[model samples]
Target: MFLRRAVYYWQLIAALLLPLWLFVGWGIWGGGAWTFVGVVVAAPVLFIAILVVTLIIYGRSEVRAANAVSWLDVALLALWHLSIIGLGCFGATGSLFAMLTVVTGLAAFWGTLWQLVRGFTRRARQTLREFEQLAGQTPPRGHVSSPEQGDVYVVYESRDQRRA
Candidate 1:
């Protein structure tokens, strides 16, 4: 279990770092610092953004408690895992590897956003329901009235009505 988490983050970090390394290595070979900054730094920054988004989603899931992970969260986690394989196999082709990384990262990004939106919307709805119920109470003004079956209801005009 612990190993899985380590591997997941390792893959994400590698996905970010490896592209930068390749770009910088190529730029050094070709004697162009501009390419190094434009390609190297940009690629990793984009990848790291994805990592941040995934962490946000995971953090929200943790906050929402057990079983709060939605299908989107699961899908993002799966994509994060798959990025390792994609990176390992296609790392030689920088463009293709970067594209794969971006695609997987986008999944993570949207997944987190979806989870957060869902969590907030759910909380808001719950609060609204509570407020509506409170507003609907008999004494809706200053104080809440406890439910008293006998005192709250009286048979005003029934054939079987009797004085208490």
Candidate 2:
């Protein structure tokens, strides 16, 4: 169960990181003119392709169960990808554009972080509530009760007999 929840969180993180990784890679290695041009052209197309594919997959009824893509995922993808493109465009100029790009990048980062934290908090609260419910239903150890008798009884039998 914990692993399943973690997978959902990972999906969100992956969406945020995809564009970030591309941006950072381009910044670090986009020295050649052709490389820069390739990235500038390819990135938006790639983003569009992925967006369409994800939407199509999520739209299908049969795929819905396996693909747990939410609107949050789509929003994160768009926000981060746009931020990356904006940063690439504005980062070269040491002016207001650069400042704006930095602000946008930081805002995207903070927004993603906030979403992750909120998700974790919600999941924790849900787990705690479930635990409380299960604990309430559980009877005390070595004790048994009969609905017909309307009485509580303690069993002094050995563990083996109790199992039987």
Candidate 3:
């Protein structure tokens, strides 16, 4: 199930990344030589940093399963794309680029949001499981009546009978 869902999102991620890189390249190509340099150099560097972090985290067995990253981690990523959009928006000197920037940023934002939510939910579930384990055995006492306690009976003695 994990791999199945990962594959589906991987496709969506590819779609999102390809267009984003293309847009950055386009922005740089049209913007200026410096902008090209920035995109070319920055993109690979950022990608490598992310790759390294991912490796470091997943490489550890314990950390890999119960992953937890800060909101800043998410924001930094969002900002990376947003910066590109900002570049295209402000530098492109055209409406098309600006619109693409907005759309791409919005898409990326939603994607990040989805991942954050999923990650948090996963963490919550893991924590719940851990707590349950720590809670130990159930209480021995319960409301259910035990059969060994003895039967209920009404005792009747004849009033007129003399003491036995």
Candidate 4:
């Protein structure tokens, strides 16, 4: 629980910091010139991607109310975040981590999307079931509903009409 909640907030921070890391990492680690070009694109792309996944995860009511993500979310996001960091490092295994980042990012996206849809349907079904139970109920024995009322009007006569 502690870890899940922390990850939820961390993801929001990562959306900003990780992109900057990519640039700084590129400068420090001495990636190839074209890799710098790739970083130029990857930075914004990663920012938006992280935001998208984060928002989608947050879209679920349960996640919002609980202020935490599921275990599955933790796993996927942890992997994705690590992969992005590894990709930033630009070591010998950078490409491998890049591919892992893409795969895990997509998995996170689709996984959250499915959770949202599934939760929606599940809640809808539960509501429908409750409605059905209410429908099956009977009103209290002596309770009565008043009949509908039509509009009412009042008129006042002027002094001239009274004189007439």
Clashing pairs in 3: none
Better of 2 and 3 by TM-score: 2
Regarding lDDT, does 1 or 4 come out ahead? 4
Query: Worst 10-residue stretch by lDDT in candidate 2?
Result: 54-63
Across 63-145, the per-residue lDDT of candidate 1 in tens digits comes to 33542445555556566545534443433564675576678777777767777888788888999999998888655334434
Q: Could you give candidate 4's per-residue lDDT for residues 1-164 as a string of tens digits?
A: 99999987898999999999999999999978899999998899999999999999999999999999999899999989999999889899988989999999999999989999999999999999999899777455554445464433435555776667
lDDT of 3 by residue, 44-161 (tens): 5545544443443334333344444334434444454455445544344545554554455455445545555666788789999998987764333333435696544445556765
Model 3 off-target regions past 4 Å? 1-29, 60-63, 66-76, 79-81, 84-164
lDDT score for residue 3 of model 3: 39
Better of 3 and 4 by lDDT: 4
Best-to-worst TM-score order? 4, 1, 2, 3
For lDDT, the strongest prediction is 4
On residues 1-164, what C-alpha lDDT tens digit does candidate 2 reach at each position?
34333433454454445445556666764656765675566556545544444444344442345444444444554554455555455345424533553465455445545555666687789999999999998788866678885777765754686667
Candidate that beats the other on TM-score, 1 or 3, i.e. the better one: 1
lDDT of 3 at 129: 93
Off by over 4 Å in 4: 138-164
Give the top-scoring candidate (TM-score). Answer: 4
